[model samples]
Target: MQTQKSFEATTQGILYLVPTPIGNLEDMTFRAIRLLKEADRIAAEDTRNTQKLLNHFEIQTSQISFHEHNSKERTPFLVEKLLSGETIAQVSDAGMPSISDPGVDLVKAAIEAGITVVPLPGANAALPALIASGISPQPFYFHGFLPRKKKDLNAELETLNKRQETIIFYESPHRLKALLDQIEKVMGPERKIVLARELTKRYEEFIRGTISEVSEWAQNEQIRGEFCVILEGNANPVSENETAEWQNWTIKEHVEQVMDTEEMSSKQAIKEVSQRRSQPKRDIYAAYHEI
Candidate 1:
């Protein structure tokens, strides 16, 4: 009896989102390799770049371009193949796709079409930078790439300066020095910063110091390769003595004191002092306006 295929055999084709290595080829996971090899077709952000990687692993899967420039036009085509039961794998040139790369749109399209999407765990730059930054990693933000325009980038940095969590960002080699200089001017020269260069590759280097110091060092070298920047958040703006004094004062007086010592706005001052003194932020705000 020619009997039996199971429920698994009837499953629709899956869209596997695989992450390629950022730098070292050895960092590529076995599971990623298996998925790529087993897939019916591989959609890459850059066929040439992905081809180099496939060549290294001796993977013979056919590749097609599926990047930002053509993703809108190509997603539907790939989806049609999935509907026909062809397993497809997607990869960016480096790191995770759809993350500062092309992959998000396609993934969204696949999901809307009711196709299964699978993400393969692999290498990334942000986590490594945050963990090695020697800063509190529990509350951290990934800011991706800085804006190329000076004014916009500075404005972006200004907002980050107020955060109490570690901030991570990616920078290009040629623009690394410029970014460091801007970070110093906007976030204060003494703000702690870590520069991770050419991560996981030969000549990988980590430079850790005050923003000004790193900026100076970066100027003396020919910057190369990708960078992951980690900036330490603003220190607690309130002092222990200030906290104790605020605890004894009326909310209005506490807000005034916070404003006088720190150059913070009234609202921000109230929030800061309230947290320091274990008081409600709203109470401080209400008293600041005599409500």
Candidate 2:
């Protein structure tokens, strides 16, 4: 149990987790600017990209590369600098560091070494997309990126489909259509979803509709920009008692029933059965196939 008084004076240097503007330069806060100007050094995910931000703000602080590929090599070095009382500010390419970025390893090292980690609140992509989604905001689950593989993505979506809170996800433009297709397959076409793109930028856009509608829209429109997908929560989540109806059934029987009742293909039925039983997909497959 470690208590951190972020502003308290200490002999050791503090590590500031600064957030950069996601898209708009105006989103950069005064405090973030000041901290960047005052810090002894800035540890950036991409020095070239961060150099642009530094140039825009006229911040002359020197930067050291500390990204995902080189984190293992740089974390110890950064920790040493902090121990030597050299203040450091860590920034990602955009938005908050460590949220789908490369700052967690260094933050963990700083904390373990008894160094203070100060996080400055500023721009982030998730919240802005959530509030504008017209979905309930109180309870939200932010799952940054989903699995890439079809089976893995399907299984993951099946679990998320049980959540009572709004779900948020980040997806690249190239994969958005495929993702929406999977969402429609797993969560049903009627489920509401919003796709927010180029957030805070002049070309920012929001495509809101049922999963089926969005899927149809994607078919005709040329997809562009990163997306923050906000999905409405399961209005009628399955409870333990709800699972009781099929809990006692054999895996094969469960898959057969789901395929027959929902009119889903065997593969989709197997994925759903695995999720419901909390069993491995391969195991369910073997049982269903009598392999």
Candidate 3:
């Protein structure tokens, strides 16, 4: 266990995690700008994108590319520079580094090497979207980007389907409609969902409605910019105690209960039961048919 006395003066070079504006350039903080200029070098997710921000702010800081493709190769080098007392600042193309972008490995390496990591709060898409979403912001889960593959995405949604805390996810414009459709299918059509896009920019917009309604909207809108989805938590959800009761029922009996309540066919009932019990559908099917 490591305790970070962040403000304490250390002889070792510090690693500053600086956040850039998600949209508006004015959102860049003074401290972030200072750190970028003061650091020996900047490690950016995309050097070209970060260079534009640097150009706009008139902060002429040299940047080295350190994204997912090269993080493994570059982290050790950055850590060595830090250990040698050369301060480095890391930034993503937008928002905070190591968030959905890159820099986590470097930060971890820096910490292990006794290098101080000082994070400067600046701009992010999630917090603004959350505050404006009219959903419960206090106990929200930041799931970031979901899996790209449909099957993996579905499996993830299954785990998150019953969470009581408001959930936020980032999605690209091209995939937004597909993702909303998937959410509607997995989480149900009537669940409340808000899509905040182009956050903090002039074209910033919010699409708020039930999952089905938003899914419809997603299909029609000329989708542009990144998307932040703020979804309401499950209401009147099945509790663990309620699900534990299913443990007492035989597999066939459990299928019968779900079939009667949801008016689903034997096949459909088995699928739902499989998800709830975290069991393979084939296993549930075999046990049910065995009875």
Candidate 4:
């Protein structure tokens, strides 16, 4: 139940979310530079890293460290400063603040405190990678990073495999091979994906192909830099056999088939049967076991 008139005057100071360059420095916008220069203080994910950017542009504004570990602690302090009429700019190491970064919590707190929060768009890796990815750009899903654990990663992929929009994920250099392997295993080999790394830098590279091909290539390649994976989404999600599966099945017949085919216990089979038919497992179990 809140309305934000961004340009309206307020007693509280403003919070400007400034986006820094992902790699190349020239991508820094004039407004971004001016905001950073004029802001009373800059809240940076890594002050040491952000200092280099400030030094390069000759903008001498001081920065306070605000990262994942410290954001919760720093948020209250920053909010108080805003209430005291001190304008602040929040930035990440690269790209936009709050996009897979810790600045999100601060922005939420700022809004709740009735501070005017403004976002200045600048360079980000996903859009740059997406447009060049040759995949469908509209209706895209930005999943910042996939799960690191194997079981969770597989479960996530199961849901992602059914999405109809282009999918995006950020992966570190070391995890690229494992991520691709999971993609090939869960999403299938034919799904188109693009891997972009070192974007906007001298060695910026794009790897585009089927998941299997890219996975194979990544296996032996000398991997470096963070990667942005753009995957083509599902269009033909319903398998012909799956479409016909629900039509010919009695409750008991479905449960028996899943138990026999999947080699599962009655309880496990009941769950699968329920998911496929969109029925409650408790109800399916009652019918199958006649209880």
| Order of quality (lDDT) | 2, 4, 3, 1
Residue-wise C-alpha lDDT for candidate 3, range 1-291, written one tens digit per residue: 888999998888999999999889999988898888898999998889889999987888788999999999999998888888888999998998888988889888888887899999989999999999988797999999999999999999977888889999999999998898888777766667999999999999998987778989878888999999999877535677987898899889999999998899999888767656655567889998994
| lDDT of every predicted structure (CA atoms) | 0.82, 0.91, 0.87, 0.89
lDDT digits (tens) for residues 191-246 of candidate 1: 67899888888888899987778889999988888899998876664445754665
**Candidate with best lDDT:** 2
* Predictions: Cα RMSD each: 9.4, 7.8, 7.2, 9.6
Per TM-score, the best of the predicted structures is 2
Per-residue alpha-carbon lDDT of candidate 2 for residues 185-271, written as tens digits (9 for 90 to 100): 777666679999999999999999977899899989999999999998886566779689887888899899989998999999887
Task: Give the TM-score (vs. native) of candidate 4.
Answer: 0.83
lDDT of 2 at 44: 97
Better of 2 and 3 by TM-score: 2
Q: Give a tens-digit lDDT track for model 4, residues 52-123.
A: 999999999989999999888999999999999999999999998988887999999999998999999899
Ranking by TM-score: 2, 4, 3, 1
